[model samples]
Target chain A: MMLQFNVLAASILSQYTDFEEIDWNKMWEATKETLFMTVGSVIIVFILGLAIGLILYETSNQHSLAANITYRVVSILVNVFRSIPFIILIVLLIPVTKQLLDTMVGPKAALPALIVSSAPFYARLVETGFREIDKGVVEAVESMGANKWQVIFKVLIPESLPSIAAGITTTTISLVGFTAMAAVIGAGGLGNMAYLDGFQRNKPAVTLAATVIILIIVFLIQGIGDRIVRRVDKR
Target chain B: MIELANIKKIYETKRGKLTAVDGVDLSINDGDIFGIIGYSGAGKSTLVRMFNGLEKPTSGDVTINGSKISALKGKALRSKRQKIGMIFQHFNLLWSRTVLENVLLPLEIAGVPKKEQKSKAQELIRLVGLEGREEAYPSQLSGGQKQRVGIARALANEPTLLLCDEATSALDPQTTDEVLDLLVDINQKLKLTIIIITHEMHVIRKICNRVAVMESGKVVEEGHVIDIFKKPQQEITKRFIRQDTNPDSEDTDVALSQLLTEYPEGKLIHLTFHGEQTNQPVLSRIIRQYPVELNVIQGSIQQAKEDSIGSLYVQITGDNDVIEQAIQQIKNMDVEVEVINDVTV
Candidate 1:
């Protein structure tokens, strides 16, 4: 009786915990794909977002006609893009993505949609960070004979670094989620694997493994981001 | 020499057009510690910004050292600004930078070589008496120390002119004195032109060689600091001087009224002595010449730039004829005496 019970207990444990249906090699590939989507999109997003953010900041309060027009145009674009849901935005940008990337079934193809949605999301954050700076500090820089660009690069950017770092970290995390969502439309990643192999085939272990890994990635991103912020933030 | 010819600044807000500084004409000589004192809305701040071209006048000209600062644009204005540094009440420091880095900023802006920037910054840091806190940020500093960093940064480009816009207003009494002393030291050591804007008359009395009293975007009175203290022409000037000479003015006024009532037979007199008269016993000499008993009510002696100014409130009990004779003698000795019996008369 004891031997029979031991065998039964082992069977039950292996049935739930054993991830046999999960191809370890494929899972590893999916993780790399997810990372590729996140890292790739974030690099472009950070640059584009910062550019848009700076344009918005420099023009917003200026009284000139051209500045007002530029401020309104850029702010509206950011608002419209950042307001859209990621899943829907991916579908909306499908044709554009296809035209540019010529594919819609891999980590690379998801790049356009991921960056489009997130760059504006990050832009808003960046703009606010710049706005939060002390006007007196900027004036002080100008008084030191720093021209406009020096004021922006040396003072404004450095002063707002911690906020900007926090911004990119959040936008990158959302890009990760957007990647998984993109997988539903044939962009291959851990989400695609979990859906095809675990959800459709009813393998709970495979889905649980993907979920755990994604969480770990997010945690690591946050930890690294916070460290950078702390290091730069003397204030 | 710096000259302003009817300079004005008008701001157009959402509400309407407002005149910040109406029209002002003045000349500031090199190596003079000039002061402009006014209440907050009197345009003291607006007037000072003209010196650096930070605020171009809506009209008129700002000629600083023969350059038309108001007409300068873009790179010219920026390079011009490099020679004119300003310090603020808040210090307006870059909290992200350390003391050394903060001071290094202007040098960086002026394209100073890296090697020289570091050494020059250290020299200025030492000049401001912040020799060891080079790596500390502004947040870690006291109000006065942050201001020292401000001074060091302002002088980094070897600016020919320094503008202090209420620089000591945020500091406590002790720190205020320390910062003022440092400013005076910098002014004398560098032979730099310094312009101070403040609402405190004590600041003007302490270090200013000359002063302009502003009221409603206009200079109501402008003269040497000692001369202003001796003979304040405008009521506003008198009020500012009273703030310095009689700090606890409310109590002093009450006590003065009480004394006037108690000694109806006495004459309350306001006496001012400057330069040589301040050094001598002017009041004692006058009292000795008259058959009168004198009571020193309130008095203060202050150094204004290189000269000393003394103000005394006294009550004299004697025959009215003797008091008149004493006043004439005091005036003959180059003392300014005002009979405070206007209320009684």
Candidate 2:
């Protein structure tokens, strides 16, 4: 029954799209590349963003460590990155990207630029998340003789989990858009497939199919993120 | 023991240097529940925060248990903080954590073993009367229950000194009484010294044995609670006492001035009765013995610890000699009398 359905769908698809002309193998490969880039960059960005965000939060006050100097430096750096457009940033980071990954035109090479552009964006979100936490809660933990590390891990992070989760969801969805833009440099993804085969060759059906798949991935990501946030948020 | 000697705090802001706490000296003995009453921005909060080293004084020595707290830093300061627990006005429990988890935070910071953390947290939860709600989140609990969780968490480290920063200010009157009772109970049972900062005179009157009244970054008056209530030395202290005692719109001084003008035929006297004298019928006795007629104006009786303090304003009408005799008679019964108006014959 499944084979019959596939053959029937193939015939219908051929009416609108040339099945013989479509490279099914390459399409599957692009789908894998998009997933690989999104997953890898999200992990790196999450860690980098959290560290940068926490430093921004901690040093932003007179009571915290290195309040004056480090806070200013980090704040300026984060703002510089956040202000630059992602497309322009990708081109500007080509040299550093080459030095870091030894290549500048594949899914693996796109990572360094993707991380630099997205981590700062996510860091701002993370900072806002931490700010949502009550200052009294931080003081209460500090009053317990908790060191800086303990206060961050045991109180601030846990208290800001729901906000952080929401930030992660937003960051991940933006990464999907960034991943599509990365395809401009020959990085294999659904974006490349839609551009080369659909737009370049005037195959509108392929473009529609790729867009539908991307939407499905985004919906799944949002659903999972919302569930985790609701589970952790007691308030 | 906690001692603050010449503590001062000055903040440099865009508006210029502002002194939050001026030079002040205070000492709290072992097992004392001392209260500091002040309005907002009066610097009581800054004074109490100095105890736990949360706020560093610009120039002073804060000694707790014979070690200067102001000199400690890093690990030493943190270790000292473990022995000084604090509860905030907002309760400040982590919303993501359950009641049991919130209570276990201090123990976790102190690096207690995992197994003992649960048992000890459970013990504290039970102590604060939150036994069945261990798994409940802070948002699920009422304001009173959240404060119970705060109290439990504060007591988790078995500290000798517990600082309450307007701990019951956000709670309702009945809940405030309940929390105050719990504090008194904890003070008696554990023999812990507590420092409570508040703007409410009734809080000081209810549970505090000693109190200091602060005004404009200075300690205006300090003494036993009953004594302060009976004989307030500062104008601010008198205003606070009157505000607590009378529910009327007019201030006590305004009311007294009005009464003096309206009732011109008698002498207006302010009478204070303390301890056993609060319950005695001293007014009726004086009226029966003397030829003076007594007209009661305003009066209230407040209970402070085991003692009761009462204040009464009365108009006495009679011949000059008889009025003097009646005043002397009331004074003989252990009441303090002050004549507000002296009408010559």
Candidate 3:
């Protein structure tokens, strides 16, 4: 077993110069597509999820801003979306994605499905973040003659920013992983490259290379995220 | 001025209904440092929360500075709340904002122009003796400094009334005295009507002119501070006074009974003097005229409100009937008297 492991390791190490055998331009384009989808979906999800999370927070029974029915319905809807599998959601959103973007095979088509799949997940995370804020902060602002908008913007948002940023970072990292699953519906990214070049062409090197690159990207994003979180979390 | 008329607050818990504050009616005069003293779970906090409209009464009217705080809603209530400031036990300052910004929060919410808000914040910081710590967050300040910041934040909108809910309960003794001094300074300088809810009689004795004793969601006794101290009407009030006046008084009670056995011919009497009578030489006059040797064994002089009230345990030796007549003479002069029995029936 040890000799077999040494032989495999040597073969893989010697294959580095075989980079010319790989499609560099295609890999670059696919990388760009992945970045585009990841960033676009993240932006859309952040806006929608933050709004939804704030709604869920403000309209809950504890801090009700509206009737109980609306709050309950919105909460249930968020739970439902968050419960669905990411891959199934991508497949299920095909017709809607095509109608919305006039295509369902490229990064643009994958954008809506990516947002739909990730928004509710991020919303729940954001809601938890907001819920953890001390109620005393809200009462203090209210006693300061702050109207609802002022309290939400000046006090509540600032108090919860660190946690919300952390939630966003976690969501973005999770979305990167979910982007690979988006490939089942023919969306372009490193996942598609790995599938087409490594799986379809029966090449193990391509799959291993993409996996290492994905791990490196995840670590880099998380490292930067932790630094940002630490800077903001003064408490 | 603040008035809470028949205020009631009930919490529907899982066990059943719990009345946190029951039909409490109180009127706090302007420039009065009113202290509400009670033990834990005594609804002192619930009553104080109503002053700033943080906890709405179940059914009653809370009128402050001519506005019905319990009835006001939305933006009007918020505006009214700005005029009535409150500080908490935990010193709730926004960790995100600096000390200056925290002090300026009310002004920012009220939309004071950006140019004026800075100066107003600076004035408040300086008022609270926090001139140079404007940029520090709450986490960087000490407990007393945080309370000073809280006080500055509470005074930002230039409120007419300041409500403190256990404001000094979380501080050490030295810090408590400093905060109390600061509050007294604010009350004097700004002429702000202050209401302090605490479980410490020492806190009440330090600054309050009038006090209310709360127990089981009701104001058991309320009156002038000297009246309550010289003559506490309720058992809980007496308990508090005893604990404060003598922490070892329980053991003293037994020792006092034993001391009475040594003087059979003496009559033990407890005299309570308050207000102008505290300064009178009436005790000396009685000792001079009557055939009685007055032995003042145990006594304490407590400063309350507008006067010094005292409770003294005295023993008289002479003719029994003469001592009784002398006690009547003292009573005729409007002094409160209680006889301590030397023998156990």
Question: TM-scores of all models?
Answer: 0.94, 0.93, 0.90
Best by DockQ: 2
Q: Write the residue-wise lDDT of candidate 2 on A1-235 in tens digits.
A: 9999999988777745654556778778888898899999999999999999998887787654568789999889999998888888888988998898889888997788789888988898898889989998999999999998998999878988998898989889988888888878878798888898878997766777777778988999999999999999888
Write one digit per residue (lDDT tens) for candidate 3, span A61-155: 66444557777988888888888888888888888987888888887878877788789888888888778888877877777778878977887
Q: Each prediction's Cα lDDT score?
A: 0.90, 0.89, 0.84
Q: What is the per-residue lDDT of model 1 for residues B144-191, given as tens digits with 9 covering 90 to 100? A: 999999999999999999999999999998999999999999999999
Candidate 3 lDDT over residue span B86-184, tens digit each: 898988888888898888888888788999999999998999899889999889999999999999989888899999989999999999989999999
Candidate 2 CAPRI assessment class: medium
In model 1, what lDDT does residue B247 have?
A: 84
What is candidate 3's CA lDDT for residue A150? Answer: 90
Instruction: List residue ranges in candidate 2 displaced over 4 A.
Output: A1-22, A63-66, B249-257, B320-325, B340-345
Q: Superposing every Cα of model 2 onto the true structure, what RMSD results?
A: 5.0
Please tell me the TM-score of chain A for candidate 1.
Answer: 0.92
* Model 1 alpha-carbon miss at residue A123, Å: 1.1
lDDT of residue B211 for candidate 2: 94
The lDDT, on a scale of 0 to 1, for candidate 2 is 0.89
